[model samples]
Structures are given as structure tokens and as C-alpha cells.
Target chain A: MKIVKYEDIVLKVKLACLQMTTDLPQDVQNKLEMMAMQEDGQLAKQMLDIIIENANIARQENRPMCQDTGMVVCFVKMGQNIQIEGGLLADAINEGVSLGYEEGYLRKSVVNNPIDRINTLDNTPAIIHYDIVEDDVLIIEVAAKGFGSENMSQLKMFPPAAGIAGMKEFVKQVVIDAGPNPCPPIIVGIGLGGDFEKAALLAKKAAIRNLDEVNPNEKLLALEKELEVEINNLGIGPQGFGGKTTTLKVNIEMFATHIAGLPVAVNINCHAARHIKVVL
Target chain B: MATIKLETPLTIDKIKDLHSGDQVLLSGIIYTGRDAAHKRFIEVLEKNEDLPFDVQGQVIYYVGPTPTKPNQAFGSGGPTTSYRMDAYTPPLINKGLIGMIGKGKRNDEVKAALKGHAVYFAAVGGAAALMGKCVIKAEVIAYEDLQAEAVRRLEVKDLPLIVVNDIKGNDLYVEGPQSYLKEHK
Candidate 1:
């Protein structure tokens, strides 16, 4: 069994938070530049230019790209052979998040109550998800989730007859209704199959995939591409100023479901899409 | 397209001349307030006491910024959703505040209030880091207990903002989309 020191996890989490929140990952930058060239509307193109400039300024200055630096969410994969020594694992992760937000000058956007809505101050107590895997390494995936795109996320349980066409229609409608609010061109993460909550989770997880990646299943990839074309064709454009590039990518992650149900969920990630991973 | 650079406290005449959709480069003193601050401001007004800051023609930014580094003035200062403050805005408007800086839609009541009084403008939503460059000076004016919700008196220079709502009741959120939306054949 591999023994992982608790401080090591803390260090990794802190580094991951700072890196994810402050920097625009290269894949997203490449996609943004590509979309910029393809964007035809002058106003939408200008908005895209400003967004790109924001990314550059954010990276160079070690500042957050958006003021809504977002709540911290960590996806942890624990290995069967690994044992955490020293401090509690969750506390270490939270400590790392607090340090990262403080040192990086990112905003503490989490409120204690959604109703009273008092600020949490440190952006601590990240929303964490853990999965025990067969491997021997601990994998930490940190994503800085902003409110704008998150507000636009939706899920619906469909009848079995709804099928692929229904899913496509639902996604298209969501994008069209979302318009420029999610910050186009968006990455549409479609989660199919699974139960209601699981489908929603799958949709969110799908957002973490790289923009350049294609779904491995050919039929699913075809559906993704078709959905992509229809969404962009809506003319919602960048910042909803009306342009050709409404979506940068469409990624679908599916799972086997019960015999009687079809579940679909859509989670939109803005152009910033800050995420990073660490293996320890 | 007209721009004004002014210091507080503002007069109604200065803001009355301004219309919605007009570009302005604001400089000098402005206050920072979001949902929390607005609620408190209204609460104080309910007690019939003077607001923490005089409202006449002053601009309020609907922003909750990240805390500053050790010596920096502010961190990641960007606008929040304007609509959240819609319920608290009309009363502030009647009190003499002239402008609001924020992103997204405002409620009809807020629009109606703006029309009743000459007011409304917005800074770009996602442009926080870039916008921070223009905020040359900032300090907490009142409600320090509010933390990020505290009202900050900020001195800006050439801060770029578009007039989204005019005295004539024009709304850019509605107009911008209407003008650009293509009809699907």
C-alpha cells in the first residue's frame, strides 16, 4: 500500500486551486481564438476579442479572469492501495482551497445560506466528490465554477420514447433560450441515460473534458456534432450579440439506464472554463 | 457618446442630461453596493435616517469584489447581476441616485423608477480584470461590517460604461437582442 502524507494532498490542492482559478487553460484559449476567426458579426467579434484580452491580462497578472471566481469543486479519485496519513483528507482539501483563493486574490463567492445568503468569506468547504478507483494514485480535479453558466444548467426526465431526438431538441432549446447569458460560444455538456440526479452529474462531468476531444462512440459523436451545428445556427452568437460561433464543442457522456426511463441534462461552461488536475 | 468625470456628491442636473445608451468615461467618487448593501440602504431609509452616503445623483455599482491583496486597492472588481437589486432600486432612485453600473437585466419597476428619474448605465459584466485598471482608488465609505457587502467609495478614471437605460425608458437588454435576433425562416 502506498502511504500519502496529508500535507502533500494539501499542497497539491492549494496549487491546483491557484492554477485553475488564475489561468485560462491552453485548450480553451486555442478554441477561443479559433472561434474568434470564425465569428462574423462585428459586435460579437469585438466581445470575443475583449474576452480573449481578459484571459491574457488575467494570466499575465496572476489575477482571476472573472470576478465571480466561483465556488471550489474538487473531484477526488482515491486509490484502493493508498492510505492518507496525518490530517483529515477533506480538511486538507478545504485548507488548500482557502489558501488558493486568498493567495490568488480570487473571490469568496460561496454563501453560507442560499436564503439568507451571507458570504462564506474564504471560499472554503469546496463541493467535493470522491470515487475510489483501482489505481494506486490520488487524482484531484479542481474546477472554478462561475455562477453565470451554472445558473443556466438544466435537467429533465424524459419518457423512453423521447430517445436521442428528444435529447437533441432539449439541448437546442436550452442553448437558444440561454442566448448570450452563458457567455458564448459555449461548451454544451450533454448527459444521457442514468437516473435523474446521475444524469445531471454526468452532464457536469462532461464539461471538464477538453474542447478538442471528440466523443469516442461514433453514433454519439454524430449526435454531438448535429447538436453543435443546430445550436450555433441559432444566431445567439458570442455574448448573444448574434454571430456564427455559438458553441465551441459538444461533449456527450452516457451511461446505462433503467429500462423505462430516459434522462437528459445540460451544463454550460463559459469560455474561461478553468480546470486543472493533479496526481499524487 | 458623452462622458462625464465628476466628484461626489452629485447633483440631479449633472445626471439628468445623460441618456441611456450613451457612453461615459466616469472618474472621481462612486460607491460600491450590491444586493446586501442595497437592502441595508433601504432599511436605513425606512428608519427615516440619512443614508450612509448622500444619494443625490451618485452612481452605485452592483458589484461584490474579491478582497484585495495586502497592499492592493481591490481584487477582481466586476459587476454582478443587476436584476437581483431590482426590488431595492426604485426607492434609492427616488432618493436622488442618478446612475447604476451593473450587468444583465433590470426589473420593470427599476426601469419605471429610472424613467421617473433620469438614470441607468452598465459596465461590461465579464471585464472585471480589465475594469480594475480604471479604478485607481478605493476605500470603504460605510457599512464596514458588511465585509464584501460594505459600501466602497471608489475613484475611477475614464471607466468605460454604456448607458443601458435612458430617461426615455430605453432598455438595452431588450433592444440589443431585438435588433440582432434573426428570424428563422
Candidate 2:
């Protein structure tokens, strides 16, 4: 069995969280450049330019691209053949998060509760999702999810009769209603076929796909294109200032589900889609 | 569009002429407050107590900034979503506050109140890093226990912001799109 020290995991988690906050991934950068070329609206194009420049400035200066900085969300995959040599695995991850938020000078946005509402000084208790795989390596993927776009996400379970066309309409309506609020030239992540909650989970997960990458499933890819076209048709261009480039891309992830359930979830990721992956 | 610079404790006629699309560089003291602070402020208003700061002709920025580092004035400061303040806005507008700065659309109730009170402004949403640079001074004026949610008075200079909403009921989100929307065939 492969043995991994707890200290190593803790350090890696902390590094990953800090990296996710202050850095914009290279893949997202390349896609934004490409989209900037294809964008037709003068204002939308300018907005994209400013966003790209803002990202560059943030990176060069070691500053956060946006103020929200977001809540820490980690996706961990543990290998079945490996054993953690130190304290609990979860505690290690939490320690990394605490160190990263404090040392990185990233914003502490986590509130104690939804109602009484108190800010948790150090961003902690990261939202973690785990899966055990056959290999020995531990993989951690974290995204600092901001409040603007996260607040716009929605999930709906439709009757079987509603089908794909219904989904297209729902997504279109959601985009129209969302208008320029979620920050246009946004990425739409759709989760189909899973049960209600699972669909939402998958939808959020689907956002990790590179903005320019196409889904492997041909049918799903076509849906992505169709939805992109329909959403841009809303004329809600960049910064909601209007133009033909309302959405940068539409990504759909699907799974098999019960015969009677037609569950779908739509998670919107703003232009600043920040995430990072590490293997230890 | 005219660009104007004003220190705080200004009067209504000064802001009344400003419309959506005009640019403004504001100097002087503006209070920072977001969702939770708005709720609390309205509660104080409901009790008919003196507000933590003078509200007459003052501007409230809908923001919750990152904590300031040692000796730093403020961390990255940017606007939060405006709709979250929708429920409490009309009353604040009814009081003498003349301008509100935030990102995103306002409800019709808030829009009407803006027209009635001659108050509205907006800033780009994700421009926090750049925005923070413009804040020259910041200190917690009230609700220190609220931490980031506290009402801190800030001094800003040449802070760039586009007017998304105006006292005239003009809106950039609606007009900006209508002016630029193309027919898809």
C-alpha cells in the first residue's frame, strides 16, 4: 500500500486553496483570449478586454482578481491502495485551508450562518466532496465560488414529457431573467438525468471543464452549441450592456436516472471561473 | 456625459442632474454596507433611533470588502449584488440618502424610489482589485462587531463607475441592451 504523510496533504491543500484564490488558470486565460476575438459588440469586446487585463494585473501583482474571493470548495479523490500516515484526512485539509486563507491575504467571506449572519474570520470548513478510486494518489480540486453567480444557479425536475426542448427553453428563460446580473459572457453548466440533488451536484461539477473544450458526447455537444446560440440570442451581451456574445460557452454533463424522473440543474459560472487541481 | 467630483455631505440638487451613463469621480466620506448591514440599518430606522452616521444626502455603497491587512486602508473593495438590498432600499431612499452605488439591476420598487428620491449609481461588479486601489482611507465607524459587515466610512478618489441607474428612472441594463441587441436570423 502506498503511504502518504498527513503533513504533505495539509501543505498541498493549503497551497491549492491559495493558488485557487490568487491565480487564474492558464486554460481559462487562453479561452478568454479566443472569445475576445470572436466577440462582436464594441462594449462587450471592451468589457472582455478589461476582464482579461484585470486578470493579468491580479496575477502579476499577486492580488485577487475579484473581491468576493469566495468560499473554499474542494473535491478530493483518495486512492484505495493508500494509507494516510498522520491525523485524520479531513483535519489535514482544513488546516491547509486555514493557513492558505490567512497567509495568502485572501478575503475571509464565510459567514457563521445564513440567519444570524456572522463572518467567520478565517475562511474554513471548506465544502469538500470525496471519492475513493483504485489508485494510490490523492487528488484535490478546489474552486473559490463567488456569491454573484452562485446565487443565480437553479435546479428543476421536469416531467418526462418536458424533455430536451423543455430544458432548452428553461435555460433560455433563466438566462433572459438572469439578464446581465450574473455577469454575461458567462458559462452555463447543465446537469441532466440525475435525481434532483445529484443533478445540481453534477451541474456545479461540470463547470470545471475548460471553457473552450467540447463535451465528448456528440449529442451533448450539440445541445451545448444550441443552448449557446439561444442564450446569446437574448442580446444580454457583456456586462449586460448588450451584444451578440452573451454566453462564452454551454457545457452539459449527464447521467442515467429513474425512468420517471427528468431532473435538470443549471449552475452559472461567472466570467471569473477560478479553480485549481493538485495531485499528491 | 459630464464628469463631476464632489466631497461628501453634499446636497440633492448636485446629484439630481446626474443620469445613467454619466461618469463620476467621488471624493470624501461614503459609508460601506451590504446585505446584513442594510437589514440592521433598517431595523435602527424602524426604531426611530439616530443612524450610526448622518444619512442626509449621503451615499451608501453596497459592498463588503476583504479585511484590511496591517496598516492597509482596505483590501480589495468592490460592489456586491444590489438586489439583496432590494427589500430594504425604498425605506432608505425615503430617508434623505441621495445616492446608492452597487452592481446589478434594481427592482421596480427600488427604481421608483430612486426616481422619487433622486438617488442611484452603479459600479462594475468584479473590479474589486482596481477599486480598492482608489480607496485612500477607511475606518470602521460603527458596528465594529460586525467585522466586514460594519459600517466603515471610506474616502475615495477618482474611482471609476458607470451609472447603471439614475434618479430619472433611466437604466443602463435595459437601454444598453436595447440599443445594441441585434436580430438573430
All candidates: TM-score of chain A: 0.97, 0.95
C-alpha lDDT of all candidate models, in order: 0.79, 0.80
Model number with the top DockQ:
2
| Per-candidate alpha-carbon RMSD to the true structure | 2.8, 2.0
> DockQ for each of the predicted structures, in order?
0.45, 0.62
The candidate that achieves the highest TM-score relative to the unseen native structure:
2
The DockQ assigned to candidate 1 is: 0.45
Clashing pairs in 1: B20-B166, B21-B163
For model 1, the chain A TM-score is: 0.97
User: Which runs of model 2 end up more than 4 angstroms from their true locations?
Assistant: B1-10, B182-185
State the lDDT of candidate 1 residue by residue for B120-169, as single tens digits.
77676566777777787889888887877789989887777766787777
Model 1 alpha-carbon miss at residue A16, Å: 1.3
Q: Give the range where candidate 1 chain B is weakest over 10 consecutive residues by summed lDDT.
A: B176-185
